[model samples]
Target: MAIKYGRPIELREISRRDGATASPALDLTVRPRRNRKAEWARRMVRENVLTTDDLIWPLFLIDGNGKREQIASMPGVDRLSVDQAVREAERAMKLTIPCIALFPYTDPSLRDEEGTEATNPDNLVCRTVRAIKKEFPDLGILCDVALDPFTSHGHDGLIADGKILNDETVAVLVRQALVQAEAGCDIIAPSDMMDGRVAAIREGLDRTGLLDVQIMAYAAKYASAFYGPFRDAIGSAKTLTGDKRTYQMDSANSDEALREVELDISEGADMVMVKPGMPYLDVVRRVKDTFAMPTFAYQVSGEYAMIAAAAGNGWLDGDRAMMESLLAFKRAGADGVLSYFAPKAAEQLKAQG
Candidate 1:
């Protein structure tokens, strides 16, 4: 509707005589857009900032000599042997990356139904941790304390009669944490999503006098289809015969994620992470706001692959897209991001700086 003053109106004036009492003020006082006019101005007004310091590189370790195996699903990502992994960690150290997360590609021969190899002090994961610490003692080492990578069945925990046993899984996880801690891991990230695992790990660590190790819980990991590429990278795709919906959080629930985070925090998680970063920015924001802890987001395999595939086809600029995607995590209030593109992104950021 149009009013007499030429302004569109949603409500009608009850009486024409009432116009006398109504005064129109046309003061050009506020100009908020002016501050957003220039690059420097926009930067000054920016609410959230992202930096190279906010990145944590995730590396895959394998058992071999002079190996650099490429993961086809995850472009530009490779699985390196322990020596090569240490060299990559050295590069990250020079680039000033605060941390590096290690995920081992367990050989099929080593994986068992119970994932008992996970508790071995000289397992692939523990050996990699020890090697990284020996070479780069000052650098942060985050180990994934989950059994999927080591389990023949490819479930995060022990499965019996078509169901996951929570209490039984926590017991093994405690032993897994102790082994990782003994191998000089700085942080133990329990990505299994098993109930009471964090508390079990905490108690296990304390009893063993490894109380200094930190726990970064994958508190709200969902059973999303986005993990297909990751499964391919870790060679677990063929082993996982069924879905993880019984244990992992449902993709449809947002409030439930907050409750899960709360429980992990109470159970002694030093930090919490929300998986599949791009799809769950809202979850990241909510968790950061609600807990006010060192919240992190995982720029999972699918997020990495999509950008790379598009860039490879000349549909998008790879470097620009990579930086933009990383910056989004920072804008969403992530203290750190676990990304496969960390090295590439960090190199570019260093060059730009």
Candidate 2:
């Protein structure tokens, strides 16, 4: 039967019916909200969990004394001096954070067309690594092997006639890796997207008797605008006049990330990373499923600033959002996350435990 315009279409037939009509029935059998109604139930059924050990704090090191220059774009992040950086590493150790990633804010005067400063033994990053390891011997130090921080043109490699030289850049990266390894870095992460860099760096580390150092390749870094805050933090924003789309992958592609991961894994990378994590969880999942290697996600600076800004404006609950974001990484199969919120998130998790 059907009803329309305040009248039933089978009204006449219904009126002519002699037998008793059965009543309509409505069934409501399952209630999924029952489990959600209780906090304990929610906790028990939570599939993905984020912990302090899953966090790797990224810190910026600059040459100075007792100075912590605040990066305005990244609200809570600052460029710390060597001593200040050591103190932060010590605090991270106290909070049970397993590692700290280092990016140097090289002096502009030290920048070169070839990024030669990157291979220097006394560069900002190399010095910072040695100092931190000396102060906190047990804490893991992950060094970025890219030359952008030390390059004046803001490209990640040596430039010739306005084009990035891939092989030449790999040669420089090999030396850079050796220098960082010599400085006692536990991991040499190559964020540069140069061809054959992973294999080159592996051989270089081996030749230098640093076979124990790990290689975490940034396998799938996209040309994302989300990295503006990071560039600003490293003082490279002003220098990067053009885009890096020539080297970085397009954000529209997902399957290409898998290919990139395969290439890096085959090139002797012990681990692979997917940058701008939230925007590419599919990429992360595909890489993890394909390689089954140690995959890390970088929760870039802009993501952190967005949450902090929203929370500061009373538009959202900061703590809940923070936990949810980190848990999302774990849910996406990230072995760990490099986040600016590592300290705060670790504190919250410790308190919850």
Q: Each prediction's Cα lDDT score?
A: 0.91, 0.88
Per-prediction CA RMSD (Å)? 7.2, 7.1
Give per-residue CA lDDT, model 1, range 1-353, as digits (tens).
23545664336454656754655343346868679879999989888766778999999889997899999999899999999998999999998999999998999999998999999999988888888898899999999988999899999999889888999999999999899999999999999999999999999999999989999999999999888888987889998978999899999999999999999999999999999799999999999999999999999999999999999999999999998889999989899999989988888888978
Candidate 1 wrongly placed segments (more than 4 Å) = 1-33
Compute the lDDT of residue 291 as modeled in candidate 1: 95
Top candidate (TM-score): 2
Q: TM per model?
A: 0.91, 0.91
Report the CA-based lDDT of candidate 2 relative to the real structure.
0.88
Note the clash tally of each candidate.
0, 0
> Which stretches in model 2 have alpha-carbon errors above 4 Å?
1-26
Cα lDDT of model 2 by residue, 133-214, tens digit: 8888999989988888988988898888888889988999999999899999999999989889999999988887788999
Model 1: number of clashes?
0
